[model samples]
Target: MASSAQPYHFGFKKSKNGELPSIAQEGFMNILQKNGSIFLGDAGQKELYLTFDNGYENGYTAKVLDVLKAKKVPAAFFVTGHFVRDQPELLRRMNDEGHIIGNHSWSHPDMTSLTPEQIRTELDKVREASARITGQQKMSFVRPPRGIFSSRVLETCKQLGYTNVFWSAAYRDWETDRQQGAGYAYQQVMSQLHPGAVILLHSVSKDNAEALSSIIDDARKQGYTFKSLDELKVKMYR
Candidate 1:
């Protein structure tokens, strides 16, 4: 379970209105012309976006939080419903600390494999839950489980007012048991970071938890500033 301070570890809860914010039809059309994914942030500057997936009641999240707090940096956490139901306080803490909480679906299912209705149901459950917990209905970002998405899934998310996010850089760290060490993980992440890079990591990995501070430190030395997904003003497409 997630701690009460960071409920984002779980999936979204319902919002009061049961709907997402509306996007400009013209802008949406422009987005469709480019690609299926959203342009989350301006690539003009050397900015980095740090996002974590599938967090639970691990003590590591606290360590990660300590590092972020020390640096006064913000991040995004895309959570599952199971994490939310178990750790409401952690979600609250995330919101309190100015971190963006995104939906990773209720059960982290592969949207590409499910029907449109099923996908909607899965997303909706999380949205409603998130809204209920946070008292806000502005969750507009989602990252499909395992990065698997389809046209139907994309369209459904757009209709529901969510921009699907995908990472530009990631490495093998999801495996908790055979996890890579911090030094190696740091090398993997640092070597790939670039302008507008969205780095994906998992909170449950010991290597990731250990490597996060160093990764941020190295990136900072290279003149990179971390931005939360919301700060990017991502333009949704497709």
Candidate 2:
């Protein structure tokens, strides 16, 4: 189907000068939220929203969930249709244990390249499947696969009744074999910490899973509290 939507790619920009929650970043974030999407939370708070992009299972999500549970920190797990189908138990546990199950698209396609109807198809497939598993028909948040997005896709999702949630803090944690030392992982995460940061983690990384507890602990030690994505405030409309 043809779509009359305008595309706007959300580039992944990292300013690692230890002076983040940058003003420019905040401005961009403000624009998106004003227009019905969000990349960061309210720039006024020292809060972190923990989110995981789960395209598929790599056997470490359970452990990651365990950490979140033990630490009592709520997180959002953005999943694909394959993830919901392949790991129903895990998906159910995430829901049962109070984590937000976000729609990450049915097949994890590059949504910016898809027309509105195609995007709806991708989102609805997961939406219905997720509701079947979680009993929540409305999945409030969606993260475009690989961080690919456009206003067209964002608005499409918003029309589909979801608020787009993007991340402000992430690292090269998706590569399973090229894993960094826990210290390195710790620094990568901790160094990038800032107020209203939306920290993204991949469930497939063992290092991310291992360093998670300490990350949360140290972040708390640094006076930052973790919140689920739903807890964060958004403008929802311009």
Specify the highest-TM-score model's number. 2
Give candidate 2 regions above 4 Å deviation.
Answer: 1-9, 12-18, 22-31, 234-238
By TM-score, how accurate is candidate 1? 0.80
Cα TM-score per model: 0.80, 0.89
Candidate 1: tens digits of C-alpha lDDT, residues 1-238: 3221221111111112212212233233333323345533455667888888864656577777778888888888898998888878778777788888888999887776777788889888887887788876778888878766555566678778887776656777887778869998988788777666667888888888888889998889988899877777544221
| Model 2 per-residue lDDT tens digits across residues 74-148 | 999999999999998998899999999898999888888888999999989998998888787778888888876
lDDT of 1: 0.71
Name the runs in model 1 displaced over 4 angstroms: 1-36, 39-41, 233-238
Listed per candidate, the RMSD to the true structure in angstroms reads 11.1, 3.4
Report the Cα lDDT for residue 83, model 1: 80
lDDT of 2 at 216: 95
